[model samples]
Target: MTGNLTRAEQKQQTRNNIMAAALKKMSEDKGFSSLGLREVTKEAGIAPASFYRHFSNMEELGLALVSEAEDALQAILLDAKALEEKGEDIVASSVQVCMQHFRDNGPLFRVLAREATGNSPLIRRRIQRCLMNLNHQLAEIIELEMRRRHRKITNPLYIAEAISTLVFNLGIASADLPYAKQKEAEKRLAHHIRIIYWGAEAMANSQHLSRNIMLS
Candidate 1:
């Protein structure tokens, strides 16, 4: 299997190995900031010098991890959109999907949540940027749904921001909970998401009523 790989493929495989090693080391107990280059290289079965061949420094490697996470989240967003188009209850379905992801990739996301608020300014910014991009993507989805349903909302972006913030905080809170507790947390999340939509619809109705009164 090793000999058949092209040089580029081998190099890419090594890079992936290094990334996997770093991610495996990260957890709620061991954050990205505390990881040592030597340990990661040892786990990857590469010399410490070989680490520099793939990453300029640990910060660059941290950014690579964040990039991979962004790809995963983007995939989730696409799945949510598909569910919406199918007339599924997107809020409940999305919460379940996100919680399942947390269960499967708990350490990876725990690292991201920690590093976003960690002492490293560069890592914080990169993770935040990824989240902001998700926020925008979600806003676009909300706006399109509003248009499809002929509903008037003041700003879908604000709704999206509220949903994103709520989900981020709640998802982190629930990630490590026991199965029953996690289900309760997810129920709360789904309820809050519905409330946000309901509140937006009420606000839109009020604005419409105000306009009618003014025209009269």
Candidate 2:
């Protein structure tokens, strides 16, 4: 027997379908500036009037997509961060998780990459806010790690922001790469992130050493 959906469930399903259609249409080629409400609704197999029932405008739908993508990205990174708390390999695991996420959500990331460079001021600002949140979460994690190890970072936020920005900006290309090329790209990303972390660790340790020397 087919179960009928409640009004709220139907509304949510329609919203999800609209967002899915938008993501499917979004890519580096089209960019955010070109997406129209009618086109999205058409792709979603719904009437243009129905789209207004869900999102107020195309920008609102795009922002919702951005919010969803950012949440997924943050969750993947946070899961990796959780593993680090258990003494597991952090950088490699995080890179793997990122690659997996990109592979699974290539269209979404492509949309993000295009939107980041597109001509829409509103979309740009929304993306920036999303990045800021991701950076803040990473910064907090880094600060805790440094404190636990009795080290002092000059600017954990800077490091975290740089890393988060790099991932968001460069990860789009990985989604389009072939298997071998994707592997190479992920490896390079892992190495670069490891280098950044190690560099910060070295600086923090040097500060610790100098403070000890001064105290003695």
Q: TM-scores of all models? A: 0.88, 0.85
Tell me the spans in candidate 2 whose CA falls farther than 4 Å from its real position.
1-3, 149-152, 205-216
lDDT of 1 by residue, 1-216 (tens): 999999999999999999999988885277788999999999999999999989999999999998888887787789889877876667867889977876766666766778999878999999989898899999998887777777778688899899988877787778889999999999999999989998999999999999999999
Candidate 2 lDDT tens digits, 71-186: 77777767867966876666767787888887888787776767876787888898888777778888887777667666666689988977876776667777778889988988
Off by over 4 Å in 1: 1-4
**Cα TM-score of candidate 2:** 0.85
- Worst ten-residue run, lDDT, model 2? 24-33
